[model samples]
Target: MAGGAADNYGGVFDGSMGFGAKPALILIDFVEAYFDPSCALYAGVEEALKNALKLRDAAREAGLLIVYTNVSYTQSMIDGGRFAQKVPPLENFVAGHPMGAWPKGLEPADDELVITKHYPSAFFGTSLASTLTANGNDSLIITGLSTSGCVRASCVDCCSHGFIPIIAEDAVGDRHEAPHKANLFDMQAKYADVLPSAKIMEYLSELKL
Candidate 1:
């Protein structure tokens, strides 16, 4: 009999990069475009949003640095480059578009850092890595929309940038389940420590600031 998926890669890919001493919580692209049913990018990820909110509050209470990211592009999408060309739906993120606004309950606090990115990976073409390093953050608690796209990209880059990527599995979602689950499995095996939001919240609570 064949072993289960976990059994197949047990020793090779199952190693854990546990939480680091100084961690930051980053919410990626939890914008109105993903939550509004009328938007082309609507992902119906309300449950994920709820979980992210819980994690955000927990991280805030723990006094961890918090960062929120949103997609924004010039009207002509000059800075968007090939990404905007590949996905025309990105037009919704053009400056001043309603779809680019933050969803009500998920808005970043006044004091929280908000990074406006033009691409999928939050660290790509952005100062995220530098910001994290300067702030002495050794790890990131990552949560956001579209598990397979922005979330996965951010996780990989987080690892590449030498920051531990702790993905809040239930706090990230996609338009469909297949890619979401596949990406989470892949991330766990290669890039990040994929965990449930509740577990992440517990971890945050246990952190010493």
Candidate 2:
């Protein structure tokens, strides 16, 4: 028998996209803006950040292709586009801004792909799809800040691109607990598998490499 909220959805949008053989790691917008208490966009996500570090380390050890996404805009912010307009806080990503850099210890390796975008989904107007394709990465292990925003968009786009999206629930954070929990439930029900960080780390560790 379906239980409570599970029954309310009428059995729709309830299936896993599952894992693909070639997995890649995508760290979305894990920058100073979202982590710094002094910054306007800060979310007080230290716990999540620490877990993400563990995930990153596991990915590195497992030899997975690591991809990190951060927003960047012209000094004029003209290239920020509509999404930026809707959320003016995006200006924090402008060139030369203090918050534009990756949070300490979360920095990308010199050889890792660093994708910069002006929008929500990392794939939009970016070379992420082709990069993933070129590297033979068919699954995305995703983490980062603001669960209701960029993280959600990136996962949906990952699914649309035929890449399996595996969202590490403990590795993603939101400024508020409500949206974070809600989006995780919604993504698990529809777009992706929301798993604990330890499970994800174990999966990566057990890969053939």
Candidate 3:
């Protein structure tokens, strides 16, 4: 860890948040646009999607509280606010748009918690924080698409909200490898404990939830 350029920075961001029993798994922005090769937002994130589904299965078997997020805007796109303006392609997520739908295997079950937002950070204007707190989830395992955008934003917000964020590296992705890898490094350095999917599964094994 000391050999990297990031090592020059003070130890202010060093240290892990460790694991907790009541961990909730968050699968962020896995909409069809991210996976559909024909879509402009597609990133060929097949590997990340595979890893996420595996973790999703493991979480279900372990009976962990799972949360899913998707970007949904009104047909008028007025509800999208500033973020939607920043990324005009986000118009795909507007109501009636096919790209807003979650991919087949990753769709949330009827009982699973669903958080809809028009912003990057899930906690920005959503009830995710209160919901996780109410469910007694002191730790959050985040895995999803676009590491540099929503994933990074959600990781920082998750930490700020006082929940230990465990970012599953193998299960998160981006349109390109560079930003994906860069964000993961920065996140591990500043905001969260970045772990591979296998390691997260190990943490899940010991949980009674």
Candidate 4:
């Protein structure tokens, strides 16, 4: 049965921003902390990573500009500010920490851009918005860790910066299913066009290089 909430929000939040003429694929914070079982921030989201890799491959084949983000902080953790205080595990991203490193296959190519951010949103305190604008990208295909946190934040900022945000639903994961699903639903309703990774791959396949 369809949920009453979906019915309640029908038409109001069902609009789609759709894909744009120039879309960039941003693989956000696919770092070792979320992948390593022993890490405090481990999300056990291997499937999300797998799907994101597929998206990355499709974007590469489509010749779309690809961007990657990772959180980093100074050794003193001073730059992290209250965010670090709120989530002590963020120390995992301090410079030279193994958890801060990219996992095996997710490393950015030499020519690809990598943005280091101190906050949840990739655009905050980073060159992402300017870089995207300079590259002539009109939309962003966002995929990343923790749907309720960084992914949601980035999606909102992506829209606020005048770019259409297309979220790869299966390409983002949280520590639990509830926040993940809730954030996806919320983002779909308010900030982005949340579509399955396969759908996004299809879109990429149809794009002209």
Candidate 5:
């Protein structure tokens, strides 16, 4: 760890953590396709979904912007690229499929933002950055499934876009625990602020969101 943020769990502070400002929330790939028991991301979907609900409530009460990233591909674009070849199973996630819909109880509110992405990184080839910038959001509280993939990619891109990426460790999930733990460690080491939800909530409460 280049900075002392890795010790932040015990009340250590780094000026870079971006706590006081109102943050936007980005929930990545929490749809039914990822939740299906047959999918590779299924194992921890239940836990992720529960945590996502918690994050949504907190963000809503804090008056922070809420954004949801749903991974969907049109049937015409099914054979897109290397990612599709690497995981042919994803072709089934075409738009309009029931499995591709946002999971029950997790739909975005009318005023919230919904970004449809064909790739893992939410900011890649999407309007996510512009949307956040337009709202004057400097910090993002991110949570969702498959922590090593979409979550990590989003965190890195969030930083690149000049926004602080705060990865809520407990609020994220993966197909297995090892990748989740490893990615969280790696993301905290260089790209983002990885912390538990309670501490983040405390920071947000004091911010005047």
Candidate 6:
């Protein structure tokens, strides 16, 4: 399931589901641990990181509020509960772990926000919602790793909190291609506007605000 080929559906997603303007960028779990092949992460993560970097650059130029989410647990992992138990890889994602740190290439800017989350959804048990609200971000452009788990969780939670979730399809990946494809398809059908990264770039380019 890890190395299987995925059918890339370029330009196939519907974008009308998301907010028309005022978009922000949320990059989730793009950490060294996820990018290292030696760890329990995806294979083509290097390629995904390249796309995410491009997205981040464009968002920054467009004056979008950029937020990065990292999974950091306590030494005992007592705070995460059942979610962390089911996914034992999370236990290694402690605050000081090298794997918990953001990938060097996509490190946060001084003005950007870096959120430490114990759970999958960035909005859950974090100040992400309030931050977005304060910044007047009604729509979110999500780019990250492990699409099936954290990405999907954040998308639904963002929608529930009244923020339109727009997944940068080419900018998100998972430990396995199957879960990536399945979650993208599911998010497209139900929660978020699953658009390719290129299309989102076009929207940002045309923004007059």
Per-candidate Cα RMSD to the true structure, in Å, reads 1.7, 2.1, 1.8, 1.4, 4.1, 4.7
Regions of candidate 3 where Cα sits further than 4 Å from its true position:
1-4, 10-12
| TM-score of candidate 1 to 2 decimals | 0.96
lDDT of 3 by residue, 22-126 (tens): 998999999899888888899888888899999988898889889999998888889888788889899889876899898888878887999998899988999
Which lDDT tens digits does candidate 6 get at residues 120-184? 88889999999988888889999987798889999999999999999999999886888899998
Residue-level lDDT tens digits of model 2 in 1-209: 24886788666866766667889998888899987788889899888889988998999998989989888899888898778788898888888898989778887889899998888898999999999999999899999878999999999999999899999999999999999999999999888999999998888888885
Give the TM-scores of the predictions, in the order they appear.
0.96, 0.94, 0.94, 0.97, 0.88, 0.89
For candidate 6, the C-alpha RMSD (Å) to the true structure equals 4.7
Worst 10 residues of 3 by lDDT: 1-10
Question: In candidate 5, where is summed lDDT lowest over 10 consecutive residues?
Answer: 9-18
Better of 4 and 5 by lDDT: 4
Considering TM-score, where higher is better, how would the candidates rank from best to worst?
4, 1, 3, 2, 6, 5
Give candidate 2 regions above 4 Å deviation. Answer: 1-5
Considering summed lDDT, which 10 consecutive residues are worst modelled in model 6? 1-10
Runs off by more than 4 Å, candidate 1: 1-8
Cα lDDT of all candidates, in order?
0.92, 0.88, 0.89, 0.93, 0.81, 0.84
Query: How many clashing pairs does model 4 include?
Result: 0
Alpha carbon deviation, residue 4, candidate 5 (Å): 18
Candidate 4 lDDT over residue span 140-203, tens digit each: 9999988999999999999999999999999999999989988998999899999999999988
Report how far residue 22 has shifted in candidate 4, in Å: 0.5
lDDT of 1 by residue, 66-126 (tens): 9999998887999999999899999999999999998898777888999999889999989
Indicate the TM-score of model 4.
Answer: 0.97
Task: Answer with 1 or 6, whichever has the higher lDDT.
Answer: 1
Candidate 5's C-alpha runs over 4 A off are 1-16
Shift in Å, residue 114, candidate 1: 0.4
Winner by TM-score between candidate 5 and candidate 1: 1
Q: Residue 39, candidate 1: how far off, in angstroms?
A: 1.0
Per-residue lDDT of model 5, residues 18-58, tens digit only: 56375899898888867788764455468777877887887
